[model samples]
Each structure stands twice: as structure tokens, then as C-alpha cells.
Target: MKFRRWCRNCNCEQEVAPIMGYEDSWRKLFWLLEFLRTEETIAEATFDEYMEHLMFFGKLAFDADDEIEKRLKEEEVSDND
Candidate 1:
């Protein structure tokens, strides 16, 4: 799957592919989000950099949710068959 994301560093639109295996993907996203939050809370990165990371993480979360939903729907259909 493809997702359009705004790149703050390059100041352009970039295409992203998110990993989609339910548990594995969620774990990956959870770690990424935790790292971002910790960095921001500790002021480890500059303001611009922190915001950029937040945006990227948010986009990933959105894609992850979409992937989970798609997988569930597919399973439902298969079960009904």
C-alpha cells in the first residue's frame, strides 16, 4: 500500500509504504511512537525536527489503522464464505 506524506526536511511530498502484519506492525509502530515521544519530552531534538518526526509518526499510525481494518475485513469475508 502507498501513502502520501509531507516531508518537512526536503519540503516535498513523498510516498511511503507501511508494514502491514497485524501484531508485528503494531509493535513496530508502538516503538517508533515511544521513541518520538521520549525524544520530544526530553528535548533531544530541535523544534522543527521534533515536529517533523511527529508528523511522520502520525502518518504511520493512520496507515497502520487502515491496514488493520483491511485485514479484518478480509478475514470476515473469508469466514463468511
Candidate 2:
């Protein structure tokens, strides 16, 4: 059985074990980026902050996505049985 982390905000599936280490940071970063891209607001400081958070969680997010997919598959199998 495999476990994974799921990011509800981005619907990203990560393969790594769940860790709250940078969840908040990533969430804020994602929000900021979305706001900038959608609102066309130029907030340099916010952009910088968003990048910093992305750097911290970029790798984690990838891994977590994989794990999440694996877990979901397992759950489906269990439910079928």
C-alpha cells in the first residue's frame, strides 16, 4: 500500500509522505500568483514571496502528487472489495 499527499488547492497529487512543513507557505504563494495573473496587479513584494514559497515546496509538491495518486487507487480497490 502506498500513501500520498493531496493538495486540495491545486488538485495536485504528491507521492511523498504528508508534511505540513510548507503547506501554508505554498497556499499563500499560489494565491498570490493567481491573484497577480488574474487581477493583473503588480505587487513585486508579493511575487517575490510567492517565488520563495514555490522554491521550498516545488519538489515536495511533485512527490506528494505521486503518493496521492497511489493512495487513491488503493482506496478504490478497498471499496470495491
Candidate 3:
């Protein structure tokens, strides 16, 4: 399925295609989430652990723009030297 993502450089939403060649991985993840949703005996600790992991990944995604900008600035400095 096609998705739309905000393009900071263009200041507009752009259509994005799913990354190629990861269908099996995506399917596995989908199945895992489905299982979790349907399972009635999930442990509290397991749910908390998964939440922590999700938050960590979310932080990485949110910080990506700043990381890219920092790297670009570092590259510029090195190029000048």
C-alpha cells in the first residue's frame, strides 16, 4: 500500500512506497502483533517490556531529523578543513 509522509525539504506531503524486499519481515511482525492482540494470557511484564522497546524505537524515529542535520553539518565542517 502507498503511504504519505511529510517531506521537510519540500514542505509538503509526498507519496512513499514500501521498502522493497522485506515482505516476510513485515508479515512476521504483523502476525506477532495480531497474536499479542488476541492472546488473553499475556504477562504484565511482557507488555511493559514491549512498550519500552516501542518507546525507544519511537524516540529514534523522532530524533532522526536532528541526527541527519547534525551529520550534514559535520560533513560540511570536514569538507572545509
Highest TM-score scorer: 1
Q: Residues 1-81, candidate 2: write the lDDT tens digits.
A: 333544548957655423333356466456444444333344434657657656656667667778999999999999999
Q: Please report, as a residue range, the 10-residue window in candidate 3 with the lowest summed lDDT.
A: 36-45
Highest lDDT model number:
1
- Score residue 20 of candidate 3 by CA lDDT: 48
The true-versus-predicted C-alpha distance at residue 61 of model 1, in Å, is 1.0
Clashes of 1: 0
The residue-by-residue lDDT of candidate 1 on 1-81, one tens digit each, is: 655554547746665554453356446664454444444453467667666766777788788889999999999999999
Question: Between prediction 1 and prediction 2, which has the larger TM-score?
Answer: 1
lDDT of 3 by residue, 12-45 (tens): 6665554442455444343344334334533233
Compared with the true structure, all predictions reach lDDT values of 0.62, 0.57, 0.54
Model 1 segments more than 4 A misplaced? 1-43
lDDT order of candidates, top first: 1, 2, 3
Measured against the true structure, the TM-scores of the candidates, in listed sequence, are 0.48, 0.34, 0.32
In lDDT terms, how accurate is model 1?
A: 0.62
RMSD in order of candidates: 10.3, 14.8, 13.4
Question: What TM-score does candidate 2 reach?
Answer: 0.34
